[model samples]
Target: MSYLIKPAGYQALLDLQQTEMGIKRIKDFFQQNLSSELKLRRVTAPLFVLKGMGINDDLNGVERAVNFPIKDMQDASAEIVHSLAKWKRLTLADYYINEGYGIYTDMNAIRADEELGNLHSLYVDQWDWERVMTPKDRNVEFLKKVVNRIYSAMVRTEYLVYEAFPVITPVLPEEITFLHAEELLQRYPGLTAKEREDSAAKEFGAVFIIGIGCKLSSGEPHDGRAPDYDDWITETENGYRGLNGDLIVWNPVLQRSVELSSMGIRVDREALLEQLRISGQESRQELYFHKRLLAGELPQSIGGGIGQSRLCMFYLRKGHIGEIQAAIWPQEMRLEAEKNGMPLI
Candidate 1:
């Protein structure tokens, strides 16, 4: 029921200058820590992609993408990406990346219709990563292992951030709890998914609400995630929840795993076909990426996105998202935040 609960003790700690410095330090530290932990390589990612390639994340199956006309190319619109979910997978396959190694890229996107709030933003930024996987490592256990590694990287990043910005102390909950969507539903049949997450997170301090895509007993997915990357059944849940009922969910949480590199035993030709049929996206086979996937040309990989802004915000312990990033804010919202003593950075 609480979409936005304004925080008390309103004070913006970092000025624009300190905020900038803190942002850079946080980013630099996270990059170093994550790359080292996951054995990931930093690569360049595109700001836009060719539409209809099925490479773009259709967030919630509805949000509009910022578009521009490609000069001298008739009728070809270059869409600013919402996120590079499918692209990274294809990149691993096309680039012939080896197993046990993956790529991380700075991904920036424009979401035209994002609801302006303390957290939501029109401009998106994250570390999108993907890597090759073998047929053997696609299961709940592997997913849990990967999640733990990612959390460790986060904790390490927090430590590094505190080193530079001693004033910012983020007491990240030590252990991350994992729970299935069904289990959450069973626990709180009356609560909505977000409400369940809030309750569970409040109790557990951190949680990864897993098993997206499949309908619950309520006949709806606890959240929506695209069909292609994660094998819904095998992938367990992951995410952090803060003490004040804040969910660790960020970036395109359910819609696109922040690091969208889910390379579980690449669905064999048969399983792939079955999934395609079930998702009603067999038509995707016509796309370049889908074709390669069907033909077994791509490598098996598991990857995900790590929200840069979310990480920065988490480290800074800022209440609203605007405190950490320089992005557009409406006058009314700015005024309201200003009244609360939280200035826009």
Candidate 2:
């Protein structure tokens, strides 16, 4: 069964028509701003890729992906992309995307195993981006520099929405705070992972939690990260072990922390092999993409996905994600959202 969240006395700030307009504006303005800030080019992305090539993101590594047989190719199966995490890196090499430049695309996918809720949906849409980089740019400082630029774009988009609608005031802070996962654990020793994020996001207004996949002093990872794409195993100057993290903010409507993006410096040859063995996914080395990386054929880069619906929902101040995008929902969840006055598109 799917889950439901009914925020107390929640109301959408924009009407259906206004919400649609705001979504378009956010999508257009943010992509343009992102491209300018990051020196990226827009590229067309794929809906599905041939199976068994290890090109798709595993997210937390256990969610099932939707796959079907291709009739024209004698029933060869293809899997809908989870995200273009690895594909973007390969593209950077193929297109000869110069150093310090990147690419972005409209990424859509089916997260069939997603537990439907106010935020989670079976239909996933996001902006997948990647850029070529040098080994010197693989540290924490460089990662934060990129994140701040993205956060700045988000703040700009928030103001743009307010310009169109007076009622939706800009709520994003001028600057976002950063903390490592270990630091957060030290502050809130008793809370679960989500609870810790909620506390930090609520207090800071906007935050970026670092070292996400590394095993902390508590002998557990603050959260799970797929082993292949993000370089979550490397030690940093601060002794933290991740070059990736999520940008989170407190959503007034839902009264919960909302994750806007998850990105990191892509893993290099050494980091990739180490992470694979640690996750017990060493068999991936034989895959086409893995072989290329292991053989040093792919370029070094940083990449990530920014959720389209999530961003729209945040800027539009919608109580539920359904107010932003159309996607499959369980009957029970639909009834609950309607009763709570959240009309699903």
Candidate 3:
């Protein structure tokens, strides 16, 4: 069954027509501002990659990847990308990209297993980015610095959005709150990780939730991430605090944060092996690309995917994600949104 959210009188926030224009202006402003700030050169990305290349992100190792047979390559299959996290790292290594700079690409994909909802569809699109870094750059301070740059970019984008559409009340904060996942669990032992993110972000206006993938003090992943990318202990998960002090967690299940991105420090050789052992995905070591990586064939890098639609949704503040993009939705959800005066694009 599909899920619904209480609009909290958010129904009349923006008229439908202005919302559309705001989405366009906001996207343009951020792309220009972020590209300038990050020194990112935009590149074209693929929707599907050859299977067995170790390029596709296996989210939590269980989500199904949409795949199709390759007509030209005998016995080969191509799968729609889940994210560019792994692929970007490989690209950096293969290209011998220099340290302290990177690239961003428009990545589009299909997530067939995504449960239908106000926030999710089989369709996915994002800005996938990665950069080469020195060994010394792979530390908490560096990561936090990068996150701050990103947050600053977001804030700048928000300002431009407001300038274009004054109706937006500047829901995003100027600074981001930072914390470890374990600390959050300690702060709210009874609440789930989602609840913890919500509470913390609500308090800080913007927050970076750290320590993903590995088991929290509660003995479960604060949330599942592919064990290959982010280092759980050192890495922090990030999200924006909402005006309501609610965690802007994308309720993909309920059409919330819309998870515009999943980014992290790419695993180094040793961390890669350790993560493999911990997740019992050692069998993957035999995969073609995995074997090369295990043999230290890949380069050290960091990367992630930022959801295009999710960013649009955040700036627009529309109740349902459908307002900004075209995608399939369950029948009941369509009717429910209409009943609440929400329009699907």
C-alpha lDDT score of every prediction, in listed order: 0.68, 0.92, 0.69
Instruction: Report the lDDT tens digits of candidate 2 across residue range 1-345.
Output: 577878898877888889989999999999999999999999999999999998988889998889999999999999998888998988998999999999999999999888888888889999999999898998999999999999999999999999999899888999999999999999998999899999999999999999878899999998999998999899999888999999999998889999999999989999999999999999999999999999998999998999999999999888888888988777777788988989897
lDDT of 3: 0.69
Preferred candidate (lDDT higher): 1 or 2: 2
**TM-score (C-alpha) between model 2 and the true structure:** 0.99
Candidate 3, 249: how far from true, in Å?
6.8
Off by over 4 Å in 2: none
lDDT of 3 by residue, 144-192 (tens): 6777777787788778777877777677777777676667888877987
**What TM-score would you give candidate 3 relative to the actual structure?**
0.90
Candidate maximizing lDDT? 2
Considering TM-score, where higher is better, how would the candidates rank from best to worst?
2, 3, 1
**What stretches of model 3 exceed 4 Å from their correct place?**
12-17, 233-260
lDDT of 1 at 113: 89
lDDT of 3 at 235: 40
